[model samples]
Target: MNSTNNRIVQTWIDDQLDLYNLAKQLGDTVWQEQIVQTLYNKEQHTQKRMQQDLWRVFDSINRKMLELFGQLKESSNSYEVRVLREQVWELKLQRIEIVKKINK
Candidate 1:
């Protein structure tokens, strides 16, 4: 990957990581449980919508990584591939954590 693309991807991953941290904080907050119980149906609907949005982002990221992987196979940009792999891993972890929070 060119330096510009690398910077862009890194910035994106950083933003996603920040988002995950905020989400974790929100999930752990005391108000979340009360809100969950008080607004069960609404909470479920919101969670479903959020999950769908996350899935769409996840799918797009996966497709981009796959395309990058093809490029990597043709070249030898191990560092870029590693960075992309880490991003994918972190994104997947965030998705799992969000799902767990919603299910709880």
Candidate 2:
């Protein structure tokens, strides 16, 4: 990503991270680039690992979203449909973040 796109991704991730804090659950990943704080070769390795993890998480989220999609199509209950829609939306956002932040 370019600097502008990268900044947008970082800001979105930070915003999501803050939401987890309010929910009292902070298991979200926090990966950011810093020149001085990182060791020369180690920084590249760490970024690769983080990107791999994000890919795995993205796959899991994709599976869940597809499962929900089927249920969403078949559901007749308005409330259940609403809940499913929200879940799918949240997963979609996460997927977007992963795609943007991951090494391409």
Candidate 3:
């Protein structure tokens, strides 16, 4: 791959890594446990649905990252690599927006 495409893919990988770390930290927060318990008691149905939705988003993001990795591994031309890199960049931006909405 060309240098530019390599750099773009590297940035996308870094962003994904950052997100994985963020999710880990958020999951480990003490307040999260309290929130979960409260929601479980007061709004079990809504809480379960919300959790399912969150898991769906998390799984989708992971799948997309793996797909990007596969594309990077199989890319045979600079053009293909650049296209894959752009897709990853767009995915990263969308993931950030999803996180913002979830946090809100």
- Which number leads on TM-score? 2
- Compute the lDDT of residue 2 as modeled in candidate 2: 56
Candidate with top lDDT is 2
Q: Rank by lDDT, highest first.
A: 2, 3, 1
Per-residue C-alpha lDDT of model 1 across residues 7-99, encoded as one tens digit per residue: 545555555456556756877655545444434454444445555655666676567667756765775677886876676677567667645
- Candidate 1 vs candidate 3, TM-score winner: 3
Estimate, for each residue in 8-79, the C-alpha lDDT of model 3 and write its tens digit.
Answer: 455555554565567568785555555445444544444444556656786698699889979899989999
- What's the residue-level lDDT of 25 in candidate 2? 51
**Whole-structure CA lDDT of model 2:** 0.70
Error of 2 at 70 (Å): 1.6
**Model 1 lDDT vs. the true structure?**
0.58
After superposing candidate 2 on the true structure, give the runs of residues whose Cα lies further than 4 Å from its correct spot.
Answer: 1-40
Which 10-residue span in candidate 2 carries the lowest summed lDDT? 28-37
Model 3's alpha-carbon lDDT is 0.66
Question: Once superposed on the true structure, which residue ranges of model 3 sit more than 4 Å away at CA?
Answer: 1-48
> For model 1, what is the error of residue 100's alpha carbon versus the real structure, in angstroms, after optimal superposition?
5.9
Residue 18's C-alpha lDDT in candidate 1?
65
